[model samples]
Each structure stands twice: as structure tokens, then as C-alpha cells.
Target: MVRQTLTKHPWWKIGVIYQIYPRSFQDSDADGVGDLAGIEARLDYLANFGIDAIWLSPIYPSPMADFGYDVADYCDIDPMFGDLDAFDRLLDGVHSRGLKLLLDFVPNHSSDQHPWFIESRSSRESPKRDWYIWRDPLPGGGPPNNWISDFGGSSWQWDAATGQYYLHAFLKEQPDLNWRNPDLREAMMAVLRFWFDRGVDGFRIDVLWHIVKDVAFRNNPINPMWTPNVTERDRLIQRYSTDQPEAHEITAEFRALADSYGDRVLVGEICLPNDRLACWYGTEDHPQVHLPFNFQLMETAWDAVTLRKTISDYEASLPSFGWPNWVIGSHDAPRIAAKIGEAQARIAAMLLLTLRGTPTLYQGDEIGIGEVQIPPNRVRDPQDLRQPDLGIGRDRSRTPIPWNSSAQAGFSTVEPWLPLNEDWRERNVAAQDQDDNSILSLYRSLLALRRSHNALSIGDLTLVDAADDVLAYRRQRANEILLIALNLSDEPRPLLLPENTCIAKVLCSTKPIRPISSTLDPNEGLVLELKEKS
Candidate 1:
């Protein structure tokens, strides 16, 4: 019997999202890797943080080539992470706390170990031969195109047995799917339904923009000035390879599928500028995604001026069909705590929770966990495997979470899958939970304040004049207006206040904001409320 699942609508407005990288988050089996049970046991901790949902990274059947990104099976949880029953139990627990479960959907490619890819590469006339992109060798015997992999080297890999080149935008072992094929589209949707039926809330579509490519096999133009940081693939403009016009339609299809399930949401990882980023939201009549993960704040230099400009730019560029969101840290980049320092991580958390959008807090960022220092011999990321000199491994941010001050920081009974940070004694969750002034406590207070005030969550944002090292903005809902000011520099700084509004009270401050204070100390930021002058 075919079970029809309906779409879930307006799912983003309810609460804060906490991202969990399951493999590094916890390990119940003490196998050195985190599993679903580990996360299940920690639900109470997350629920206490005022998080409305959990966005778990891929736990699907995989060879761990990309740490679950290269999925071998979309419908089943990997044995390393536990079975389907464990995932079901985790979902049940999350729901019991009124929390939603968002899973990572690697729509761009599949591990070569996947049955579809294995069958696709078996023979030229195999039944599933066209499931993945395959091309004949160029007239001169090299790859058919000049496209390069994001991980490094040519994007096309030749299968000696098949005498054809296959497309892999990432690691060679992960082949790009042929999304241009309708059969493949239906099959992928079936994977989505498999989870939807399992009571999952939604998905964080990984590398969503790379899902489709130009079918013409055209060569991409070369960049005029290729920075060393730019990948060999990024040397080209990516004109034909990404941001395809058809992507919007595909997103709409996904939106429609998610809509088939009541209140399910779609959040896409769109790496683009504000203007281009807003386009993924679909046309006014039909919305592509509830929120396209906004990384502008994460990439921008941490400064009042830069942050103010980014906020204004993103707000101005938001499409009518979509909502705005802000992400300061994620598993792929440097930790925010490391990026801005411990004091600044607290300030950033304050700013994140108080902002007017759904906020996503990366797993370890709450406790101010900085990036771990991994030596050359221990790097596990594919990016580092390809370019060691660049110091680009994301595993620095993927270090195991410090649950408590125990052997292996209470994450595992034995040595962890990755080296434990030597400083876990000071950074463990137990230490922070007991300290009233800790980052974890600050996050709790900030989230609670935001949840208590609708003006902070869904209100309209208005920028105010703030001097260098100071950022000031107002969030307004109906007649209630809340003004927030942050001093982003060391030592004290003065900010220009809006006219006609008397200072009602200081909503939040890293340190006490002195009356008529002109400067905020290093790492200090504050939220102020304005009173209507009688």
C-alpha cells in the first residue's frame, strides 16, 4: 500500500535550532564514535537550553568517506550510529520534549558504495546505468570536461571497466547524481518520504546548489585572478556547474514534497551573496525554502560596521517568499569561539539569540568550545587530505564535545575517534553549568529572553547610528520597540542612541553598562530597551 505523506508548513517560526554532529557529539557504546543513543541520552540537556529543534548531521548508511555525507543508503541509519530503531527512539525522545528533528540530506552526491552507483558503473547497458552522470572520454583520452573536484583534482574519474568518466564534485568516491533524470528525482523523494514517515521534522539539504549541473558538457570559463585559497575547481567561474536556473524548480519540488507532510520545513545550505541567495526562496506564490541558511555573519569580519552592513544587506535582500536566518558557526568552518575568542563567543551568542530570526547554535559553540589544535598526522577531513599546506581541515571544529570532566571528557570510555583536546578540564559542560557567568549560562539567559519577548524573535529590525566598535539596532513589533547595542572592541566605546526614546532598561549586557557609559570593555555587548518619553 502506498502511504501518502502531506507537507508540513510554517515550521521555522517556533524556536531555536541546535545542530548536532552525532559522530562527535556523544558515544554511548564507547566505540570512540558518537551514536543516536548518545544523543538520545542528552536530550534533557538540550531541552533545558530552550532549543526548539535538533538538526543532526547525516547518520545514514555510509562508509564514513565524508563522515556520513557520502551516503550509501538514504533510508537507513548506519550501524556505526545505530539502527533504525535507535533513530526512532531518538526522534520519539526529541518529540517528547516538543523538539523537532532535522536531518542532513546530502542531495548532491552518493558514495560510490551505494547500490545505485555500483549498478550505474557495472556496465554501459545496466538498468541503473543513468542514475549517475557518466560521460565518454574526451577526443584526446582525458576527462570529458575541465571541471575539478572541490576536494581537489579533476571532477571526472574514469572507470577502466566501463570506459567512461563519472562526475564527482567532491571526493572521487562520491559520484554526482543525475538529477536531470526524472527517475532519479522520484527515487530521492522516496528517500525523503522514508524519513518523513518515520516522524522526522525536516532536512538541512547539503550542497543544495550543486545538485544540478549543465547537461551540455560545456567548459566553464577561467577566473581572471585565481587566489591560492580558491580550489582548482574555483579557478573557473562555475557558470555552468552551479546556481542553475533549474535549481529553483528542483527546490520547489522539494518544497512541495515537504509540504506533503504537515508542517515540515526545508532549510537549504545556499552559498551565495545576499541577492543571489534570496532567489532560492522561489517566486512569491510558491516558496522554495522556509529558510536558506545565511552564512554572511559567519564569513564577515567581526566588527560593528561589518556586522551592521551585513545585517542590513541580508534584511534588504530577503525574498517575500522566505524568512531570514543567521548562522555564526557550523561544522564546516572555524568555531565562533575560536574566531572571536571566549569573551566574544558569549557576546556573539547574546547577539544570535536576540536577533529577529530563527537562530541555529552549533553543538559546541554554546560552551565556548574553540577549534581544537590537530597536528598534521591526525587531520581527517578530505579538504586537508588534498591540501595540507593550506590548514583547511574542518576537523578542528569537529572535536568531540566535552560532556563532563571525566576520562576522555566523558564522551567515551576509551580514546575518542579524534584526539581529545588537552584543555577539556576547563571547557567541559559540567564546569560551565555550575558557573553562573559561563557562556552556557549566558546562552540560556539570552534564549530565554528572546523566547519571552516576541519582539526579539519575529519583530522588524531597524538599524541605528553606532560609532566605530559599536553596533546598535532596534527590534519592533507593533508598538513595542527594543533597542540593542553592542561594543565589539576592547576597552569602552560610545554609541549614538535613537532620538525621542528614553533608556528604559538594559535588557542584557556582558558587564554592567554604566549610566552614561561611553565605552564597552573588550568582548562586552549589550541589549537595551527604549522607553516612550512622557
Candidate 2:
């Protein structure tokens, strides 16, 4: 039996995405913050990174309460990140360089300081009061329900000034919008149109699953496996609070808006189980999110059996003709190197880039950058500040990319907002960019190979084997075929090449030496041209 997979429809469907956190990417002014001009200054550097698109984290007008994730003005850029003019130039640079730009759209919520929220909370009689989800206090004067915030407290914040409570799945300072409101939907759609009109490519919609809370506003059921060690938000299953039925309709609306302007893309951030996650793809004829940001690699264990099982299951679970994407690292999670150790990080990289779907790489992971331990006094993440004991902060992974071996790692002139450790200085880009065996070089090689190979870019994936601490797969496009063998362990593992399959040539390897054989060295991987025996 042959299983037909979804063919590529757009460049984004087949290309790689690079994510940059503006505040930490590069500081052109030496003001301890990265800005649009800084990003423009480094356009050539990023343009050469072999990525098809750049997904910039929120740069909108903000109060910095939750960094840029708490967007205040959707239509303008923040002063710290440069104004709208700077943004226009950056967009132009991205387009002029023949690269795409994906803005981080924070539509799930807006900063409470925004004018709409300000008016919404002014009084019960405010015309814009219903623009945000507001519920009166219980008869006894507590929260309206048990909804919890992602930042470690109650999701419903009591607003004494308004004599009611407002819902916020994240921080109290960022209230959830009333997505059910027709006016609010039109306003958000208009914001999207505003950016698309300015030549922006698309958006990486943040927390797409969190939109459209349950209309009834019921309390979330308690998780049967809740433990004292986990954060409070995880205590509940979040059935009614998130991933509600209305979300799909909202997703379709978003899809319609993006479709109106042909050639635009929409990559949503969704973290869900395979079954629930597959629904985001919409119908076979009508697609919702172009790429529903796959993060299974980042969330799953790095072992061979685990990776093979999840990858196969996810692939099989996709809707007919549904495209898949993968991400091994992100700003909110620990660096892949830190989670899986340095040796396995290389294997993870090969799997991410060579997989059947699109791959998104974090800024500094290309150089094998590990998590930076934030000192207690230097910690600034709201997650860390609110719940220091939970160990879920993001500052460690959000450190600036080390551009050189000099002080500040060439990321800034003065001391950066976050300190760079000795590892950053040693593994800086300037040092590894010239070394053929360095992680950066390996990344470049893999990306180049994938880009040039038709089998790798738009091909069908078939699982070959998952055993002996090695996971193997085959990617085929027409007559072209390539075998990807990954050693998840440090000790040597005999690669189980598919029956009648032989290695014609070695495409690339993670280890220093490339062997045109079946046996894989410790923590090594190879993409080889496969030829059948005569």
C-alpha cells in the first residue's frame, strides 16, 4: 500500500524559518536592546543563513510588562524597537534580499495599556467595555471562575476600578480579547491587513490555541495527575479554557483574511496532542493555518524509539494532504543542547532539517549555544519572577547570539541586558564560521544540502526502522531517494539499512568524519544517497 502525502504548495511550505527575538538579536545603537535598525544592519548576515523566512518576535508598541508579547499597539512599532519608519525599512530589506518576513502576531491578547482595554476597563458603561472579556465578581466578591493565567496565577484578574473581573490567560496586564465580538474580530483582521498591506509576508500567530475561550466560562477540571512540583496552571486540564470549538471558526476567519491577499502565509503556534492538533489543518479543500507550528521535537524525548514513534504517529495522524512542520528549539523552551546534551544536539539538527516538513531554527542554536544560567538578581522573565521555584523561565534561552569572540560577543558594544558566559564567547559565530567541523558549519552544510536536494525539500517520508538507539528514515522524490540515519546514543550503533538499500554516497554527516557505510558512530548521523542492489 502506498500513502500519498501532501505536496508542497508554497515556498514557505518547503523552506526553513529562522526566529529572531528583536530585543536580544542585535543592538545597533549599543543601548543594550536590539532594534529594527539592528536587524536591518544584519540583514546580509541573516540573508546568507539559508533560511527562506525570518519570524521576528513582537516588535509592536508595548509596555514591556511581558516583553513584546504583550502588544499595546498592533499597527505601530515600539520606540525601543524603532518606529514604523524603521519597520518599513526592515520589511523592505527583507523583501529586497529575496527573503520573507513573518511578524509575531499577538492576537490572543493585547496589553492592558492599549487604548481599547483602557476604555474597556474605564467603567461598566464604557462603549468599549465588551471589547475584552469581563465578568462581574461572584456574589461573595472573588474571581468569576477558576480560570488560571499562564504566568502562574489566576487567569481572571479583579479590576477594582471597573467593579468587575477580566479574563487573562497570561499575565494580568494582558487581557484576553473578546473574540466573540464581531467588532473585535474586524479590528484584529484590520490589523493583519495593515501589516500585509505594508509588504510583510505573513505572521507567526502566537498562542493560537489560546484564542476563543469557552463561551460559558466554566471552571477547568482538575488534572488527575497534578503534582505539587508543577506550576499551578498545569493543575487543570484546560478543557473549557482553551482549544474550544469556536477556535476553529476563528482560525478559518484568519485563514480567509490571509487568503484574500494571495501568497501570504500563516504559521500558528499550537501545542496539542496529535488528534486535536490535526484539526487545525482545516478541511482538505479549505486550509486554515498554512503551517500549524509543529513543536513535537522540542517537547518529546531525544531517544530513538520515542522520536520514531511520535514522528510516525504524527505523520500518520495528519489529514489527507495535510502538511507538517517541525521545531527543535524555541525561545520559551530550554536550548536543545541543554536538554539532550551536546553530542545529541547534532543528531537533533539533522532530524529537524531533513524531516518531511518545514523546520524553524532559533537564533543562536545554529552555533550549538546552550542555555545560559540566569543569576537570581539578573532574571527578568515574568515566569521566573512570578514563580522562581518552577524553573520555567525563558531568559536562559533568549540570550543574544554571540557574533564574535570579543566582549559582549559582538552582539552589542556595552554590556548586554543579559550577561554572556564563557561558552558564548568561545562558541561565537566568528570563531565557528571559519571552522569546517564547527556546529555552525554543519548547520550551513545541512541547510544547503536540503535546499539543493529535491528529495529532501519536497518528498515523501517513509520510516525504515526505529531500534538499536538509532532511528532511520527514507525521503523520496520521484526517482531521487535519501536515507537519514541518526544515532541517538553516544556508543556506536549498527545502522539497519532498509532491505535491498545500499549507500551510493554520503551526503553529509554530523561527526567529523563521513563514512559511506551502514554503521553509525557514537552520536553521529548521516544523509546518504540510497541505491538498490542489483
Candidate 3:
């Protein structure tokens, strides 16, 4: 059997992070929206669920444009969610359960209603005018450049009073901050200190690569491979708009500030290719982020060969000092069960927990909740409304988590802000908690196994040859070796063990009954202790 041993790795390096979309987790009041107290009430459930840390999406003061991404006040809590006292109580509860708390930091933009943005737009000579990007309109009475907003339309919005246009990478109400401004940078850095002082373990920096843009405000080159099916924002290469070199300087500064607060971690949300993403890690002497949030798994095709290459390529791209991270589902992406089948999602979970990095699990995914369709009248996402053709609305994935079969799926006393899945009654945590064969049970088993096996965490990973439909890898630490084999296809596949190696024991599996032979059931995954043939 795989043996457990102690390691000196930080919690962020070896721990499993559970992402909580606060608005949809639970509701203490009957306001149809979740609150901090609701989250505190569920602390026992999360503790027992076996996560090392909890990362909450933004709960700061906002106008609700883009949910809480557009922060109005960086230090204060939104009245809708709770007051400062409620947040303090929640933090205490999380610490009491020995779970780290990570808050989402949105430094790229602030709501138009923010005081800084309000003053910036008030006059050309306002002290904070340069806090946001503003430029004179083109001589031909058009936007200064051809940059497009991620939501849709022009990235530049005209201000009739100032006879200028301000850049907004997303909705017009969410104005991009000028990270180039020294004063603005320092001010945003203070926001980090404020949270660090509150004992927050770390932050998940949103859109870390979009913090700086090309100084010239030049038009992005048109994409040669643009297709009608893709979003309009992808029509251009975005070379001049995002992933700029100067952004690394800002990330480095963030790392410096976070380092001052001992044991704190910085996780950046950078959506770039593996090579480009690796740059965010900086060098061993000048590290930027603890983790750059690898998202290749979320975008790659769910097949053995493709996934195997994706993992190997990512591993090859990382710097020696950079620790890896994996994310399969998030508030912004479709649910794993919706993207792949429920059976494959189980296999996906095995892959996530067993991989050689910190894994982040989205709320409700443990219970196998899929995407919930939002009706036309109830649509809430601005992205879906602005770019209806792209169908990139996130409302389906951000639906309320189903806790039970009661009204509103036990998420709220009243109707939740978003709809719940139709199968919530049968696919909820309460229902699955009682079923041994449920996906929730499999997740619990996987998490428990991960906690007990040193080979699964902080171990070296080597890809093992396997059948065409089966993806296999061996995770080893010293004398301990555990092989993970995943059947990516819908049909049973033969497990091809490495030469001179035999399965000594089944440590854990996606199915209720562990297989004893060299055959994998449809969409089954197994973690087996390997031994050399005597």
C-alpha cells in the first residue's frame, strides 16, 4: 500500500483549494441571495469534505455589474453579503476549521460607481483623472483604437463632457485601471495590505495579464484564424491589449508585498499558452506568483492522447522553482458534468486530485451538478445579453448549489438569484451523502486517499504507457509508487501495466467496487500501488 509521510511544502503547494461562489453557496436570510452567515453555517460540511483551503469569489462592495468583479470598495464588504462583523466571524470560523481563506482580488478594473472612477470621470484636470485610461477621440470622430471589449463592441467609451474616450476591456461600467500610474499602483497595493492585515491567507488575482496594456494604444492586429463561431473579441490577436511585458513587473510587486506577510500565497488568473503562462512564475530569485492557475485541462479535448500531451507539455514548460496548479471547473466555465458526461467527470476528478500539483475544485461539482439552463426572461449575465450569438453567458455555471431536495434546493428560503438544476433533488449533497455509489462519495474517497498518500501530493509524475483509450501515469516519492490509470472512452479498456510491475493493491477508484484484474470499466479510474514482480 502507498505510505504517507511528512513534507515541508507550503499548504498552497500541497493543499486542495475549494472555490466558493459566495452568491450561490447558501442563503441565511430570505433575500434570495447568499450571505456570509450562510457560508459560516456550512463550515462543518466543508471541513468534513476534506479541503485545505477555501477561495471565495469577490464579496466586496459592488454595483453587481459583472457580479462582484467590479469592485467599488476594496476594503469593505457589500451590505448584501454582510457587514465587516459578519466577515470577521466567517474568517474565524474558517480558521477554526483549519482551512485557509483566499479572496478574489480584481485589480484590473473597478465599477464605474467607484469613487475613484467617479472622480476620474468628473473632469480632465481631476487629481484621479489618470487613475483610469482616458484618451482624446480620434480626429475622424471615432474611438482612439480598434480594441474591442471582452463583453462586446468597442473597448473605448466616449465621454461627451470631456471630449475623450476611456478604455474598458469589459463592460462600459467596468473601467480598466491604469496600472502604469505610480500612485494608482501604490493605492491598489494598499488594498492587498488591508486584506493581509485581516488575516486572509492569500488572493486569487483576477486577469493578472490584463493589468497593463501597450503604451501606444495601438490597434491589435486582425486574427488570421478568426472564425464566425468564435467571440468577436477574438477577431483580433489582442497582442497590444493584453499579456503585456510590463504586467510581470506588477505581478512581481504583488509577490513582494505578499511575501512580506509570511506564509501568504499569490495565485494569478493568467489565461495564456503554457510557455507564456510559465513566464508569470518569474525566476527563482524574483518569483511573481505562487501559482499562475493552469487552465489547459478546462479547454483541452477530453481524450487520453490529447490530455496526456497537455499534462506533459505543461510539466515541461514550468520553471524548476514554479509549482504547478490545475483547474477543471470554475464559476466562469461550464460545469464539468455538462462539458463531459457524468461518468467522465468522475474520472476527471480522479485526474485532478491525483495530479502532481495543487487542485482547485468548484462548488457543487463534487455532487455532479451540471449546467442549468436560464430562461430568456431570467437571464442575468451581461456577456450573454451583449454577445447572444457567442453564447458565453456564465449564468448556467454560476447557478445556486443544491444542498438538499427542499424548496430552492436548500440554497435559499426564497428563489435563488439563479436557477438550480432540474435533477437537484437526486443529485444534491444530501441525496449523494447517503449513497455509497454516488459521485460525491467518489470525490470524498479520492480526497481521503490523497490525504493519506504522499505519492499523490508533492511527488514526481511520470507518464506510463497504456492502451489508446486509457491515460496512465505513475506518481512516485522515494520508495512509494502509485499508478493512476483513467479510461477516457465509454467502453471497457485493458490496463497495460509497465514492464516488471504488478498491481499490489487498489488504493482507491472512481467506481464503488474496485477492479482486481487488468481491465478498466467504462470511464473508470484507479489508483493502484505498484510492486516489482518477485
Candidate with maximal TM-score: 3
RMSD of each: 4.0, 2.9, 1.4
Worst lDDT window (10 residues) for model 3?
Answer: 1-10
C-alpha lDDT score of every prediction, in listed order? 0.85, 0.87, 0.92
For residue 407, what is the lDDT in candidate 3? Answer: 89
> 1-534, model 2: which lDDT tens digit per residue?
111333545878777899998988899988988999999998998878678899999999999999988888999999998998999899889989888999999988999999999999988999888899999888987999887788888888888787888999999999999989999989999999999998888999999999888888898998989997888898998899889888888998889889888888999998889999889999967678988888888888778888899899999999987888999888899999888877788888899999998899998888888768889988989988998898888998888878998878888999888877558767888899889998888888888887778788888999886458999999999888899999888888887778887878888999786545547788988998989989
Model 3, residue pairs in steric clash = none
How high a TM-score does candidate 3 get?
A: 0.98
Off by over 4 Å in 3: 1-7
TM-score for all predictions? 0.96, 0.97, 0.98
State the lDDT at 222 in candidate 3. 96
Full ranking by TM-score: 3, 2, 1
What range of 10 consecutive residues in model 2 has the weakest lDDT sum? 1-10
lDDT of 3 at 344: 93
Model 2 steric clash total: 2
